[model samples]
Target chain A: MAPLRDPALEEISEALHAAPGAETITRLSAIDAVRARILLAIEHRLYAPGEQLPPLEALAEGLDVAPITARRALETLVEDGALVRRRGRGGGTFVAASPPQIQDSAVNVFRADEDAIRLLIDQRCLMESALVAAAAERITVEECDDLEALVDAAEQATTWAAFHSADRRFHRRCAELSGLVEATSYQTTYEMLARYFLPYPLDRLGGSHREHRAIVEALRAGDGSRAATTTREHVGSLRRDMFMALPR
Target chain B: MAPLRDPALEEISEALHAAPGAETITRLSAIDAVRARILLAIEHRLYAPGEQLPPLEALAEGLDVAPITARRALETLVEDGALVRRRGRGGGTFVAASPPQIQDSAVNVFRADEDAIRLLIDQRCLMESALVAAAAERITVEECDDLEALVDAAEQATTWAAFHSADRRFHRRCAELSGLVEATSYQTTYEMLARYFLPYPLDRLGGSHREHRAIVEALRAGDGSRAATTTREHVGSLRRDMFMALPR
Candidate 1:
């Protein structure tokens, strides 16, 4: 197949090559780029479980890559247990019935380096602080109420599992209320980084709930500075708590 | 060759596949992962320009991937203009004599979406704020002097080009002074994002220099909060300035 004639892609390519004195370019091969897009789509649930992917030829045509390239990409996914291929009538590639679990080892790699963990925390602090500030400025009373309700649900949670679920929802809702589409991606990435620090101590739940309450109050009052400060402190506390709990 | 059996590769693969309840696991082909690692190393200058890479067989052995996979990874790099392969004796893979410029298209892809640009700025604000705060608390007198020197250089700069170079140095030095190794990577990523909005109008150079002076003063005084505020404002101003300059 001829390379896809995508104007956006072409524009990107031109900008990279033509930028004067450009030293180095960060790039992905055609196959890798296609794979990344498909993976992202699947992660976002654009393709439901057990969904059949288009035939190799059609998939290759859509992405504007050779069929061999597309097949290689699919093969890689198959190796990762993300897809299964079958032959015969009505047989083709399908999302795996049960995709392999992200090995603990993978998460371990992210959490492996002490410095990386701290950096991740620093990054989260920065993104969330800005997000809270924006949310405070734009959140309506109804959205404030929604956040308060999530906080209440967390406070009343009888199990760690239930409380954790509420905690995730509250933070996510806060991002949504910020009215920035980009915050959603930040929130998603933040959640992934946080997975390594999950099952926060039950004893600290009360304090955490209070912190959430403070954030909601700040948002309700349209106090951007206060919202940012509270968010920073809350996230900072997580980092502190995690570091302190690590074995010496 | 049988899949190169390296403990490190096995660890990574197991970690990827073994995470419990991993509904979706994002992965790279062995070739892609190896390529990414080598590329990152090159970008970081682990392999300087003009440096010759080890033979393909050795690289394959080191990464514990099949020799063919390792060869494919190198081939991809060659295709990207990151490396050159020569034929006959004394020829292996060497860093390209003159690497292809990172295409303007790649940078444009980053700057194409207005919201993505904004999100990038917000992320930078957060990280830099935290970084400056830390730097304020811990920066030594010698480090403070070093920063002041950079600021002075910017102020004395007769040309916009000179000022821009000093400006980049000043910001990078700030991250380094923070005593956080991770901050350096954040600073690098932030600079790449900022490149698209560069070539500050000559009129704004003086104002930008003053902001740098204020940040230096805050660092000198060991005022973490003030340093954070000043740094945040400085970065925020860049975002504001760029947005205002964009065509309506």
Candidate 2:
């Protein structure tokens, strides 16, 4: 494949990392970029999960930032639970074995670009559909039963954050069943971008909860296509119901 | 979502990045890790496409490697066309707008782990099917004709690398039609692992070329399911036909 990045996405990437982008897009600090760089290293596996990083001085120098800048960036990421540091010998700084999903402090990029947002949704629809179908084919009756608990957990969640967290568990469990390592991992990493785009709401919860249950039932019946269809419809609805899709 | 990583995947990430995992895994020096970290920054959007990076001294210290080691790593990546360097004022180090696919000097990691290979293949299948369907929904009659050219480009390729390159152009074009930025980006990055797993050969060229042509036809007819089914079958065949599947 040519690996040609879409022109719009190329701009989004710039907006994400630079201060010189289109007006209205929030500007990021050098420190933010540094933290993002280190986090990217972990997400991309350049810095293995749980591997100790270089000394602060070395890290700061190599990154070409003031030592204070590197130190602060690292500290923020640590606060986000993306990294963990320990004192004494045999410890400097380490990528979290299982890093928490980062909440982007900047969501303006998504808010400002409707066309890019549409593509984002489409891309997600493609991935989520395939993952659900792949998972359906591999999900067993017992696993289907486990997925039900996850579904109910979302429906019963009292808050938007709670529901979103539970909702992801349901999907994550399905992806686990598929055993597609990189596909699943790709989805996981993509969420760092995906999650920040929409502030959660219980506004569409009832309908979404129904779809979740429907997907599980389809999986239980070994109907991969049916599960995939519901998944597509669910994500496709984002075009009508997502933040940008509403009055905004 | 939960973003819970599977234990097997966790191991693969570590294997891909570190030298201390499976005995059969090739060792990566500090310099290799340095190159990877910098590359990850680009892929993760922390560095951004075409963004300028820090001076060599700062870069060397930030990553905690010797200056010479940093220099060599930077040079190799630049030679690979992943980065571009210019001398004098207003020039330092910049990530290439469109970087080339990296060839991992190491494939032993994939060879040694049969299970991970299966998952990687499954992940690709998931992505390809969805991307095909997504493209089908959006593909124009004119675009279908362009896809035909890509199919032929792959078929007429005289070498494995040429065919792979042409073949990727076809897929990348399809993803562009969908506009899913992170999903496409995730796939591009995942290939760093996926591409290295199997050394290219003319072994399965004929069938692959046929599938490529058929997928384009399915798009021409706007038959998303047909396109998706064919994709799944073609990728499924890899589980049976890949090198790991071959009797040693």
The DockQ values of the predictions, listed in order, are 0.08, 0.08
Q: lDDT per residue, candidate 2, B184-225, as tens digits? A: 533532453343333233545789888888888888888766
Q: Write the per-residue lDDT of candidate 2 for residues A1-248, one digit (tens) a residue.
A: 12224332233343333222353334457686577557655554556678777778766655556999989998988888889999898878898989876655433333444444454455556567777776766677888889999888888876555676676667667766766543543453245234333323355468888998998988888766677778878777777766556541
Give the interface RMSD of each candidate: 14.3, 12.7
Q: Per-residue lDDT of A1-248 in model 1, one digit per residue for the tens?
A: 12223333233222222212223222356566456545543543445578787667656654556889878878988888888888899899998876664342222332333343454566676567656766776799889888899998988875555676787788877877766544654563465344334333355567798899999999999976578668878877766666323433
Docking class of 1: incorrect
After superposing all C-alphas onto the true structure, candidate 1 shows an RMSD in angstroms of 16.8
Candidate 2 regions with alpha-carbon error over 4 angstroms: A1-125, A133-153, A158-169, A172-248, B1-17, B20-119, B197-199
Cα deviation of B224, candidate 2, in Å: 1.5
Q: After superposition, how far is residue A170 of candidate 2 from its true place, in Å?
A: 3.4
RMSD after CA superposition, every candidate: 16.8, 17.9
**TM-score of predicted model 2?**
0.46
- What is the DockQ of the complex in model 1? 0.08
